[model samples]
Every structure is written in C-alpha cells, then in structure tokens.
Target: MKRLIATFVTAFLTCAAPVTAAELGDDGLHKTDWMRDTFKDLPEDLAEANAEGKRLLLIMEQRGCIYCDKMHAEVFPDPKVRQAIEENYFVVQLNLHGDIEITDFDGETLSEKAAARKWGILFTPTMIFLPEEVPEGATAAQAAVATMPGAFGKGTTFDLLTWVAEQRYLTDPEEDFQRYHARMIVERNNGNTE
Candidate 1:
C-alpha cells in the first residue's frame, strides 16, 4: 500500500511539472535547438535560411529580462510555438547589448549593439522577420517585412508565425495582422468548450 501511494504521488508530480523549452546559456539567454549559431552576418544568415527553405528570424533579447524569461518559459515552451519555429524559421538570437560583430546586409559592419540601435530596437524580445528576396544595398532593418516588439501570448505568437510563414502579409494586405489575429481569436474561442 505504501509503495502504491509513493508511486502515485511521484506520477502526479511528474504529470503536473511544466515542460522546459530550452536551456540557458552562459550569456544568461535561453538557448533553443531551433536557433542557429551563425557568424551574425545578416546576408549570410539569410542565404543559409533560404538554402534550408526556411525564413530568417532575428530575435533580439537581453539578459535578465522578465519578458524574455516569460517568452522562453511560457510561450516558447508551448508545443505549437516550438514546432512552428523549428519547422519554418531559422532563428538567430542576438543580444540587445552585446558587443559581438555583425555584418549588415548593406555591407556595413557593426557590433550587435550598434545594429540594434540602428534598427531602433529599444525593447527586449524583438523579432525581425525578413523577406526571401532583399534588394541590393538595403540594410536588414530596411528590408524587414514584419517586426514584433514584445512578448505575446501563445495564440498571437502562433498566428504571427503562421502569417509570416504563409506570406499573408503580401497576399492579403486588406486583412492586416491585427484583423487576422482577431478573427483567429474568435475562431479559437468558438471552438473551446471549457
């Protein structure tokens, strides 16, 4: 009887534990399997993403950021978000304040911090989504199709990824992301029973 109780208690606790989406790096940032460890060169990264038949996604985050933590723990850990990111995006993580060198697409070389400043990134958890075809001599910030500036809930994040992956921004200009997200929210709510 004692053995059965112990086994049941352990199983209950295990079932209730949250899933971990990624591990933490020494840089104090969450490291996921979906993220690439590239040379931080925008052009090269884009090319690599293209070669892999994936979209280039630049994720800018800072250390000890509560929002970033929330994204890592709450958002990214969700299976839908993780699978969408892994399957459709070649993610690259950049520190908002790090000094690592990065070569922008326009042939300008700058540190990650400089690039963030130039791109007007003032917040943690900024996601920059690039188009497949970029014009010559255009910087990454100049060519980005969409940018998410903060952490969002699972459904929003999933919709954003799906929208970008489907290239709906170009095809459906009348139904913008906000409208699409609202529609999706209603559809999801209608499908839920509890």
Candidate 2:
C-alpha cells in the first residue's frame, strides 16, 4: 500500500510539473523533439502529418527575437503546451531569413524568407495551423485555419492549440476564436478570472 501510494504521488507530480526546455540552436531557435526536420514541402508535409494523424503546424521564428525567446523559455516549456504540440501537431519551423528552399501547397517554391514575405508574416513566433484538408491550388497561408501571431501566455497558447486540434473553427463557425477564448477563460478560471 505504501509503494502504491508512492507510485501515485510520482505520477501526479510528473503530470503537474512544468517541463524545462533544452538549449536553443545557433540560429536562436528552440529545437524541440516535437519539431519535424522535414523537406519543407507543404503538400508532402501535410500528407505525412495526415498519415500520422497530426495537424500540420508551420511556426515562423527569427534569430535573436526576444518574443521567440520568451515563447521558447516560458510558453512552449509548459507541460500542457508541450504535450499538446507533441501529441497533436506536426511542427515545421521556418527561419525568417533562412535560405532553405520551401515548396508551398500551391506548387510555388521559394526561400523561407520569400515565403514569409508572401504569407505576410510580420511577426516572429507566428504559428500557422492548417486544416486537415487543404484546398487545391491554395498557398499554405491561404489554407490556414488559424494563425497565432506573437508570444502568448501558457493558457492562451494551450487553449488555441486545443481549439485548432478540435477543429472548432469549422464545426462551430459562429463561435469565433475570440468568443471561444472568452468562454475558455471562464472555464479555465472556474468562472472567475480575478
């Protein structure tokens, strides 16, 4: 009985504790185990993500961006957020000024920087969540179900991940993210954000 209690306590603490992240890369980007080192082809990546039953996530970050640093150091390291990304997302990281070539879903191939410009990604730490079924001839940006720009708190980030993973944007179009987030805030705080 004592051993049983110890095991239960260990499980509880493991689930409750925040996760510490690894050192950032020379590019100043977080190298998480969940991130996929893919060929950067949107169509192929989407197909692979679907095969693995995961949502395709394109995250844009730049070198020495403090916002990206904050997300890596604080937001992404949260156990819930980390678990959400690892379990539900097939993350592809794109450097804002990287020279690596990328192939868009629309069949347009360009450098990472060019694609960022084309997609109108003006902020570091922008996370673009794609729908399972992307429309033919649509760019990745055009086919994104939701876009998260800038660093956010752990709750908001986790909620957004849940919202996208659950495909709330499609199933309930009337309930926009703002409304969903409001409802989520109430629920998360037990109806009292104060």
Cα shift from native, residue 23, model 2 (Å): 2.2
CA deviation > 4 Å runs, candidate 1: 1-20, 191-194
* Cα lDDT tens digits for candidate 1, 21-131: 667798888898888999998889999999999999999999888889889989997999999999999999999999999999899999999999999999999999999
Q: For each candidate in the order shown, give its overall lDDT on alpha carbons.
A: 0.92, 0.91
Give the 10-residue window scoring lowest on summed lDDT in candidate 1.
17-26
Sliding window of 10 residues with minimal summed lDDT for model 2 = 17-26
- lDDT for residue 193 in candidate 1, whole number 0-100: 36
lDDT of 2 at 5: 100
lDDT tens readout by residue for model 2, 34-84: 899999998999999999999999999998788887898788888999999
Report clash pairs, candidate 1. none
Tell how far residue 37 is off in model 1, in angstroms: 0.4
